[model samples]
Target: MGDILVDRQEMKKKVEKFKANGPSEPLDNIELKNPFPVMLKEDMMKMADAHKQQHHNFVQKLKSRSNERLEIPLKQNSKIDSNFDELANMSLDSDDFKKVSGCYHINIDAKLHEELCSKFYLKKSPPMSVTKYLERVNRLLCPSTASLLTAAYFLFNTVFNLKPSNMTCVVPLEAPPEDEGEIQMSPVNSRNIFRLILGCLRLSLKLIEDKNYKQRYYCKVVGMQNMPEMLRLELAEMFMLDSHLFINQYVLTRFIFQFKVFDHNVRLLFASMK
Candidate 1:
């Protein structure tokens, strides 16, 4: 019992001594050894350079591939003649005519305009429905009557280096209300209208050429199956409008000149029309 008391007293003394000393060093002052080896600054710089070089090489390879893919081959006379022959032989049936005349109820299914905008890299949002876009296009193209004024504007800009300002005046017309029967007028600019026309054209092309079954069906239902034919008809109509209005002397001339720069197939089609 005496020995136990002595040992307890000794333990107490040691505990009191430890209490007096507190910690050997402050927690923040204590040094810790890392398990992993520390990398040298030189080594880190070398690694960074290697990574940058790798990225540059990867970018170069992608650019090369892109260039190769976008390269167009020079066409021979035989191919051009064949394309012209095909265009000459082409004929629209009764059903095709009906489709072109807007007799068919064409519905835009599955938010196709969004998909097309994404594909074309167009940042603009599409109208609520494809029909609405079509209506806007028809209004712009025809105006009071079937006319080629818009076509002439684009052609003149592209071919004759004429600015859009020279072609059309920017009239502040009220936009159609989102809901039917709303007579609110929002001031729309001509440049925006031009962008809308371009967007509609690109959207129509995307719909007609989309590989997906549903999108293709929607395009077919809307009489957009023959995009080339539709464009040709519009151009022809524009020529008729030009004859009547005599708006610009170089309208058709610019179109013909610009048409010559197109691919042989497209050139052949237009040539056959002549």
Candidate 2:
């Protein structure tokens, strides 16, 4: 009995020793399968670039849609057009954040030309006139009605005081030369009215749009050789206009009426609305 007990103890001890040692191969030396695929640095960069492109495309789509909504506001909603109080009291976003098709397309016409000359101080007639340059601008930016109207407002305000009832826009003084070394700027005669109007339009586009176009591009469009001078004019306009740019639907509607735009309803709205 004693010998059998001692043999059993020795057998248990051997089993314990074997369990502690594990297998003959070390765990570090054993090869293990990977569950995930390994990606190289180049592959990772390409994936990142693809994501960036997708994001850029999404942003561009948003801007395009926004501009489309804002352009060509020549039409009216019969349901809303009659109610002056409602239109006036309506929220800022009532017309989709001031992007009214009412803010919609602006076309150059005889009526616009008459207003520019009689109201604003444009002396020259078409072909080489401010109106002709505006026609070119229409091709370039496709400015919304709101943008064009707001720009007109800006330019009109520049050379006229609001207090006067029958005031016409005055001709601006000659702008300083692009080269600071030059003694003085050239005369801003009747011929240079186009430049003033173009600057105003550029500023208006900047305010109404997605703020994507650069001043450098505006300089290119105006055939202004000096970028610095262009920027100076932008600032100068801002200063003259008292830095007020954002326009409301009410004011915009009034502007349309002031310009005698659209049909009898516009004339009616002008006559009726406060």
Q: Candidate 2, residues 157-193: lDDT per residue as tens digits? A: 4544221111111111122224322221123455556
Runs in model 1 deviating more than 4 A are 1-39, 72-274
Task: Please list the C-alpha lDDT of all candidates, in the order they appear.
Answer: 0.36, 0.51
lDDT digits (tens) for residues 173-250 of candidate 1: 122224323231122233233333443343333323333335344334434445564454344333322322223322
Name the top TM-score candidate: 2
Range of the 10 consecutive residues with the lowest summed lDDT in candidate 2: 163-172
Name the top lDDT candidate: 2
The total of clashing pairs for model 1 equals 0
- Residue 11 miss distance in model 1 (angstroms): 37
